[model samples]
Target: MRFKEWDDYIDCLLRQVKFRPDHDDIRAEYEEHLEDLYGELVSCGVPEDEAAKDAVRSMGDPVEAGKLLNSVHNAFLGWLERLLRWAMALLIVLSVIPLLSVALAGGESLIGMAGGYRDTQEHGALVYSVPVGESVALDNHTISFDEVRLYEDGVFELRYRDRLHLFDRAVKWSYDLGFSEVRDGNGNTAKGGSGSGGGSFLSRHQQYFEGFSPDIRKLVIERRGSEYAYKGRDFRIEIDLSGAKEAAGL
Candidate 1:
């Protein structure tokens, strides 16, 4: 139960508190304390009116109390504290957004590795298949050749995976496994190929070439040229196709 005396005392106390922004909070605190004190006094057999008056009196002079509270809750410090809290919140949001993006990209990469391989295999009859499983460390990436598939229609497909090192992953930078130059054992270049790939942190890649020959005993895949080609990194993968030729009955 609220009494007029308690209301009047709190109003007077709040008038002396210079920080208007904190008035509501301070008022609530004082009201809660007075209610508790008033309840305790009434439980001990004091009359309701007397209990209310005693609770207000026990709080001491409102003016002096407000002055002490005003000193403690400096307006400038209150505003600075609020500003720092907001800044910390913003910093947390900024940090988490990139991590979420990397996680999402990593998920998409896994899905692409599974789905894209299945889609490519459906295009032609399987003539020869080999698991290369070779890795080369270049720049900020460890590029691994997972498998190679050649179809009867001269479609050559290479499945590879690449992972960015810790530092590169932290900065959200990615490595591109660009077009590779394919050559036969007799130094004949295989032409006309297209590539597609996607991912972050760790990524899967697929490159397709046309006019591959089953008679070729050796195949050399080389990545070269400017940053636009293979991000300025050079590496060679030499694959012996003798087994592929025998398997395909060439």
Candidate 2:
């Protein structure tokens, strides 16, 4: 078991084992196991390199070692994946209450409207719409709005907001029919920009697009209660659906 060229020999063996199509983590575990056995051998009486060769002898076949390592590592990875999935499920369940609270609060103000909304994938575009008042004149295949209704107390008022995709301009629109909240955001990584101070609408919007890059010419649309913000390479569009159900025409 005591040989001089042990480390070099074991290295060659391990390299050869890798060519047999074993799992990578299995190979890594066996590699570490071999190193530990070598350390124990040296600690007893053998020379450094000789101890390594003795260690390799005790390791059985390289293919067998790889199989054992595969069993252990597969179990470990399965456990880790389950833990991650449970963590995600827990996070989503906990977040639901807070999200509902915000939606309810936003629905209370005059700028807020009560209605059902739907999102459809059609005509190579994503469409969202809210039907106000009777809901009949609103429900349709196309997402574009022809009319909207704003509700204050028990009164219903008509309003309209148009959608457009513009490029190379920083455009802002007022969510309130009377221009109550403006979704104008300006900030950099340094200054803690405009979104921090103005427009709760924009603050929530920035959260939605946390990792997305922004376009300087992006269009900002302010509906009654929320901001629909999106950026593209040549063009950008931000839709404010804050008080969308009550806009004007429905």
**Across residues 124-203, which tens digit of lDDT does each residue of candidate 1 receive?**
78888888989988767888887877877777777777777757534545654544367767777766554546566667
In candidate 2, clashing pairs total 19
lDDT of 2 by residue, 124-213 (tens): 232223332111111111112222221232212122322222221334342212222212234211111111112222111111112112
CA lDDT of every candidate: 0.77, 0.37
Clashing pairs in 1: none
Error of 2 at 54 (Å): 1.5
TM-score of each: 0.71, 0.26
Off by over 4 Å in 2: 1-28, 63-132, 137-157, 160-250
Candidate 2 overall lDDT versus native: 0.37
C-alpha lDDT of residue 201 in model 1: 61
